[model samples]
Target: MKESLYKRIARELAQQISTGTYPPGSLFPTEMELCEIWQVSRHTMREALRELTEQGLISRRKGAGTRVCEPPTSGVNHPLSHLEDLLLLAKNNLRVIKKIDEIVADIELSQLIDCPPGSRWLHIASIREDAQNPDAPICWTDSYASTDYARLRTFIRDDPHSLISDLIETHYGIKSHEVHQTITAVGVPKKIAKILNVEPDSPGMRIVRRYRDRDGKVFETTISIHPAGRYTCSIVLKSQNSGE
Candidate 1:
């Protein structure tokens, strides 16, 4: 298989933007310049720009041309990176409420939390609502915590707005040494769709996160399913001295 010329151009340009070759708040090369450099038609250049824009890399204005976007404060970059950027992008315009319960873990969940099958655990379910329309649901999240850390129950219950890692530090004196996140696309389950106000088979993004403490203890695991149009993620890599 071969990459199309326009896609190749788009990928190369995206890389440049990600690598700081095109720093934030800086103008990108003009479309005519890109056309000349890539030796492509005007439409091809425009298509490449469109691809970059879709990835949240740059913004274009009719009179001002295209400028590289600043990494979003609420996205994968800033101090609150783990918390999704709910303000800038429409996809994340939702509020979440947490519900706590106790449950016995099944095999799949047991493996995720490093517990034996059928282990008792505290489960927290979070429902997300569209900010614009309170009636619209956008995401559903479920988190499992080891029963040994019963002290965390109060922390989780009290701080709905705090990041889980932050809560762990505040209450348990356990600081997260590393965080692992995985994302996949799946069809919404009927139960979740009913809450999200979408068809049962609607597409969605599923994010699974595993939190580890300083001593390598797995403290929490969370799974979040977001409606197709209601969430997105971005990663920004900067050179050590780039000061981004």
Candidate 2:
């Protein structure tokens, strides 16, 4: 089967991005330029750009031209990968400005946080705003921490700029030497859809992160979901030795 022209265009542009021909944080060609270069109609060019945007590769503004976004990381490179990193790569570019704390021990959550049944756990709920549009929320994150790290609460409140792991290590001397991540696709629940401004049952990606300290104890676990249209995760592989 032959692929559509729009798909071909999108794939070519994506290859450029992955190869660094169109480096991150750079401006993409104008729509008119794309139309001219591809010899396609304006509508087809727009569709190609939309595909790129939905894949989280580029951002377009009314005044500013489309801009390439930063590459997405697995949160493994840094002890604490801030939400900002993902948001910057998000199509909507949401910002998390406030964090609220609570305590919960729901049956399912207890297991996820690695605490015993009925064990007390710290919870942090945050609302993130689209960087390009402040009025809308791109997504929401609810995080849980073990009771032993309760004293680290103030660290999160005082320094919202730091990654959660960094805050934990800085305040309680618990370092996350290992991290486990799992990703899955799910339909948006009604409550989450309301918060994310998407229709109920919309497609979304759920990412679960478990952070383990130097002693191999689980300190923190977070579950975050983003609307499918809002984010993209890509990986590039390079061969170390070729043509042997």
Candidate 3:
């Protein structure tokens, strides 16, 4: 789809502002001048200018025209690029093993992890804490790995890079090439809240990730809980409908 006149004007102005064409603390063109320059109606000009105002690039006043402000801070924001990025981030945290169990995937479990009902698997309970401060918990993860790789228990305790998918590739040569993730916000559960050191019923982020190999077989699934403000996930999306 083609860009709208207002969006095109807004983007052009934003680019100019970012490039210092319209320097900070400088006065912007009057509404009438902008309308004449863009050959657009007053409504279109006002809408385009509104975009810059909302983005904190320009301010409007009764006496003073729109004045440019300093650009917003660009730090403290990160995106989850892909499985590799997520796996790399795991190395920065410490996973303390809680216990391991063998279980049958009942109806609830099958639906939760998209696994075959009644199938047996290994359930590993662990808490990931910030390496900088062990007392500051990051998340509690309940992981299910294919029972065939149960022998990995020996290395999981001592290995610094002990992500289940990483262990599978190391031990079985089945490299995971993709990850499917789902995030939800919910009230903290009793078991997870205790592990994360937060009060019961506190707001939390529940993340479920399935690691799959080249053939799309999900060999590892992890359900993790992070207390409010402890962990965050970010994503950057491209405009799919744009004629790129």
Candidate 4:
């Protein structure tokens, strides 16, 4: 699911703390200033600040401004938020294709992918694994792309980490301008439970993503699943006014 606005703000702030943008013992920007900077209501800003305090990263005073108490003890983990981090991860992880087949999007698939019903898409299944230890699986992903991109699937056989967007960019001169993702907790389905090595209905994470070009046209969609205890996504929130 999309993170709550306050939670997203909190994560940004936490990230700044972890990165030393707002060093320990420093006073954070005022709540009103933060509200204006982030374009959020005061209530929302307070909630975000409250989260920082509860996490032991900040301290709140009645009259004085909020202060950074300490840096985060642990660094956030993958799936990463920054492009640099993603490229780094791709270098350390490998994508292995399992299946690639054409499928007409039904009502359910249409809703899940934000695509038109009856549209043709190539459904591709793959597993991303740690390069050093192939047995250590990162996650199982089901990717969808327009049938126009089907020929790329043939090329993927040779280059396992070949991404659909890259192929589209390479062959068709189209580039993904934006990528949106939603992460949520869910129960492992029977179909993929065996692949994930988790019991049916076991706790898992569902990450849905859509890739769009400059014209705001979506050309790719992906749904990735991972067992909860085995994988996690990390995030850091920053205060808007400080630009930390």
- Please tell me which model should have the higher TM-score, number 1 or number 4: 4
Report how far off residue 142 is in candidate 3 (Å).
Answer: 0.5
Assess candidate 2 and give its TM-score to the true structure: 0.57
Report the error of model 3 at residue 86, Å.
1.1
| lDDT values for all models | 0.69, 0.66, 0.76, 0.74
Q: Estimate each model's TM-score.
A: 0.59, 0.57, 0.66, 0.64
* Stretches > 4 Å off in candidate 4: 1-76
Q: Candidate 1: lDDT of 140?
A: 84
- Rank order by TM-score, top first? 3, 4, 1, 2
For candidate 2, the per-residue lDDT at 244 reads 39
Question: For residues 56-115, could you state the per-residue lDDT of candidate 3 as single tens digits?
Answer: 668999897789887434311113544544543465567888999898999998888889
Number of backbone-clashing residue pairs for each candidate, in the order shown: 1, 1, 0, 8
> 149 in model 3: Cα distance from truth in Å?
0.4
User: What's the best-to-worst order under lDDT?
Assistant: 3, 4, 1, 2
- True lDDT of residue 8, candidate 3: 64
Highest-scoring model, lDDT: 3
- The residue-by-residue lDDT of candidate 1 on 1-244, one tens digit each, is 1246666687678657656889999999999999998899999988778767766778999999889999654312211132322222312333355567789988987876677888787787877555445665656888777766676667655655555556666666767666677888999989778777889978888878787876877788878888776654655444788675
Model 3 spans with C-alpha error above 4 angstroms: 1-78, 240-244
Flag the better candidate by TM-score, 2 or 3.
Answer: 3
